[model samples]
Target: MSMSFGKSLAGSVLALAAASAAQADVPQVATDIAPVHGLVARVMDGLGEPALVVQPGASPHSYSMRPSEARALEQSDAVFWIGAELEPWLEESIDTLASDALVVELLGVDGITTLEFREGATFEAHDHEHGDEPHADHDHDHASEEHAAHDHADETAHDDHDHADEASHEGEKHDGHDHGDEEHDHEGEDHAGHDHAGHSHEGVDPHAWLDPENAKTWLDVIAEDLAELDPENAETYRANATAGREEIDAAMADVETMLSTADDVSFVVFHDAYHYFENRFGISAAGAISLSDATDPSPARVEEVRDTIRDLGVACVFAEPQFNQDLVATVSDGTDVQAAVIDPLGFELEMGPDFYPELIRSIGDSIASCTSSS
Candidate 1:
């Protein structure tokens, strides 16, 4: 064969190998939850499917990472999680396990407004008392109660001051920096490379996805990030996200319409996780049975909730899949209040590109079930 012909053949082979290498560089994405996976899945449609870390029926709050899941994280090009507040177990693991992977916390993304746990929600903030204050002249017990109230008021004021100061500092930081940078901190001040540490989990609700608007914000961010990572699929990602937003908007409209007719709808949930959902849709929950599925309320607290149920004439007592149903039964034992199961985590539902809309609809359905009764 001619030397010139041999050289041309070698060049062709090298070009084909380079093309394969470029395709390999397309990111292998990983997400922490089913709904997040659902969002990412839509953005990556026709490009590739993302790996899900937490599977259906598992609780992200208390889930232990498995060996295979760790390996998936290590192999991923980018990892998307809600935030450390929702999945605290991932806080240490993602840093250690996926050290090289690009980690994006969805809650930290701009345009997504976060909700706080209701002021009087069952997850009461730890009351750190200030120094004792002098009480007015009164009976011993009355004076003590007044002093305690004063201390609480003082603590609340101090917390408010600290939070305001932190917000000012955060605003200054953002004025000179990019919004989506992992290092710039989304929740007030930076936490020295730990974004989660910057925000207090006590009052900040981590279930931001429950709000359709937040989900729309998420789609925009997801498409932007995915396009940056995979330029070849930029149009596809953006187009899919746009379509997803439209679907969410339409579904949310329907949800609002469906639940609009219920009169005096009052209920209780298994935990404080649904504040985002309840607040976004203009639904009011009486309270939660517990702060979290991992923590059980005391007998006295349980009795108090029962009294609340009786007094308020609650329509339904909603239970979750991760926790036991016995508590729900006990809460509604002799009452006419209906006991309904609402799976916030989509425990029994199928996970895919459609999971997000379906999950939202399920929540609407559960609320409608009891509210429509009376």
Candidate 2:
């Protein structure tokens, strides 16, 4: 029988439970992608380094579990994923995983304001061609803030995800989406802590962690979960999360500053992964060539983006380091869209094994310099 993601996850928890001090290697953990892995590594604080199923320069949008990655998850103490919608591949099977292994959906981590995953929100879509649904939380806030001015759009305007604004003009606007995917089931919690089994809401964007602040939440949750899993090293997990958050806090400021006042407020890109990045600093791009990680741009999308770029006079159309370069070159080439590479995964940077911080900062610097060079 084929092992499911949940079964693999359960086996991972067991393996991790058995990882006593006698073990030579670090505690075992598995992440869905480089960013989450980097955050996990930070929270783990060298006690056990986590591995990512998705390597750097890879698109998390279309990523699937490979045998090697699945086996790795089986050996993990905990498995960290972005969220159900972000990584739908892990959804059904993740439940089957052993209860011992911790499954973290970072975007659902508390204390962060998540955005709506709706049509014409920020970039385009990759995985969801079916339709744009509303998260109960985001949808509420959007409606509450229905009268909110364009202030939300100031910095993260295009990426702020105040779909409520879009809602009004959209025949109906809504706000305050809180999928809270990371809410700890706290054992005694409702449904007998079954909420910890998975996510609560849907259509809330999972890439919120791509924002440095959101990533800090992931680190915090990782540390908290680690402490829960290994009370002996709870302090260690806390310390690591604290350090990681500090780094992230500082890095977020830098990203904010880098994006605060762009030389060219309007730019373009191949993919829409930079919503967090763009929102942090208030920079607005014309639009993205690619909508989601799993999907490609259609001919209509291409023309629409082309027209937008031309109208907006965007200088740069950033391309991701891991995706197929052909689309970017094919459509963006020769146009005013100067294609540049952006590393959302922190793919190539070897900032120690602690590359997550370095990854965000590096990307910040890249965006900062992109238009300013002119």
Candidate 3:
């Protein structure tokens, strides 16, 4: 009886060891940013932790991967990123270092909604009278026509009204108008030229992670990719992803509740990175201080943003930790606008499965706080 009992105990121990070994065979996953890393970490919760390429608080726009990060990419079985648009600097490194890894560009994933980049530093005020519908869905053709008609009327009025003083100031006014036109044209060209500086993609905004909907979609994508790489833990990966999606849904609901009072509040961002978040929540930024973070706002662009804030009665201006805080102060100075910091990258948040949802809530809280006081 004693010998038989000992045999059974040894058999049970061996079976437990085998189960542990099987569970340990997770794929080596690497992710680009903190948010992406957090999503991947959720899907890989019990399986393993994925390596983060770009550390939190570092700008993915102009990042140089360290040797350790490169080594992680080199050893990875799979790699995920937003794509070349957000981190153009990582493309070459991925091509060379992660040659064998299954590369998944989250931005190109299907079912994810991508928004176009707002053209200038200052954006046109978005009309939010349509409940829950994003400003992107609105037809701007009518507005464009009205603007053109107004410009034509202004030209006609100027031609007819100023003849009394025009004789004396004609040469001065004509020269000034021509010079102004030339300077405007030059600035436009300069802005257009830098559109591809940090983000190579012309039309698609790469900051899709700001939208909780997109993050939910990406959770499934990450699970499927990880499942393909490590079929042994496929069920665990998928279960984790489903749980993550549910968490995101809960977080989104909380954000909606938080921002319910902020519908009428208008604000501006340091740059046009929050459109996805704004669109998702049915809120909108009045304008951006700069078109892209890679380039500084031109003097004219700064003045335009100032005009937007004053004209629109914008209540708040958000600064990002990744960029200059002085710019936000400058834009909000001399106005009744309140200034606050919003970090989309989840830089200060503890990295893990909870990071994404917390990041979303933090953003909502930041916006609500400023708008509530104003």
Candidate 4:
């Protein structure tokens, strides 16, 4: 009896050691934003959790990394981000800190659909084709060079601001039409650098995660990357990703059903960040108050948006949680337009595999509730 008990105890110890070894073998992954972190969390469900670089309620456009976040990057086995277009601030940090880590730029991923930046405060209807191939102008290599050029241009523009200001005043008095053209030219020249806040909006819109299809595509990419690092769990990673894709599809279908009640309802967003979600669901915003979230719309642009609301009889103006609510209030003050809050970042949601789908559903709910009432 004593001999049998000793053998059983030895078997239990061996099993525990093997389990601990497998756990230790899991890779340390890091992601830039909540949505990406949620997706990676889904893919790495059983293996490990990826560290989130940009925390909730913080704007990615102008975020400073905490020491803990920097350390997370330093210790990461792999780091994933949307690329310099979305987070130029992170580019240098990643190069400096996570030099040994495998970096995956999601914007440069193959089979992703990218949309060009729509100019001006109000957007015209876009008829641009969505293709599997990345746009030539937005090729990863070209984008990096363009980003570098924008940096140099920003310095030059800063130095020549006074000269440009004088030129503007002189041109304004000469002819209103010529002045308008000159102003447009100046804005175009600086658009990629700083005019629309700090974002590099010269080429593709970097909010691709808003599109469920892109999210699905990214799941496979995440799985493949994780598999490459830990081949022993390749099947598990791929399976988890496949499961994540199905969850997104199911959530998308539910969202479609929820939004069906508000098909004819017109709306405007705080910024032009929802094109991917809009285009995916066959709905479009009448106009955006700002070109991007980080930009503050000029008075003229705000007036134009007010005109849009009055003319289109827009049902709702969606405000973001991270932005000032006063802007939405100003836009909706005189009109019967219902002001509703929509969060693109899922700030309030608990971060996990389910967060992405919940974020999409919440937006749908916010829009549907307000528009249906209107």
Best prediction by TM-score: 4
Q: Evaluate residue 13 in candidate 4 and report its C-alpha lDDT on the 0 to 100 scale.
A: 100
CA lDDT, candidate 3, residue 104: 81
TM-score attained by model 1: 0.72
- Models 1 onward score TM values of 0.72, 0.69, 0.78, 0.80
lDDT of 3 by residue, 81-179 (tens): 987667766766777888777788777666677776666665553233323232232222221232212111111122211111101111112211221
* Candidate 2 residue-wise lDDT, 170-289, digit = tens: 111112222222121223222321111222223465667666767766666667666666777888888988898898878777777776657456677666666666555555555666
lDDT of 1 by residue, 258-359 (tens): 788653677888876776776577666777776542344545556666877888888888988766568888888789998888978777677677778888
lDDT, candidate 1, at 105: 76
- Clashing residue pairs in candidate 4 (N, C-alpha, C atoms within 3 angstroms): none
List model 4 lDDT by residue over 1-374, tens digit each. Answer: 69999999999999999988998999888899999999999999977899999888765654557788999999988888877666766777887888777788877776677776665655543333332232422223322232222121122122211111211212222111232233322344343223433334456777888889888888987888778779999899999999999999988998899889677879999878887888788777888876653455666677778998998999999988655567788888799888888888898899998888888898888888989988
Candidate order by decreasing lDDT: 4, 3, 1, 2
Q: Which model, 1 or 3, shows the larger lDDT?
A: 3
lDDT for model 2, please.
0.58
Candidate 1 residue pairs in backbone clash: none
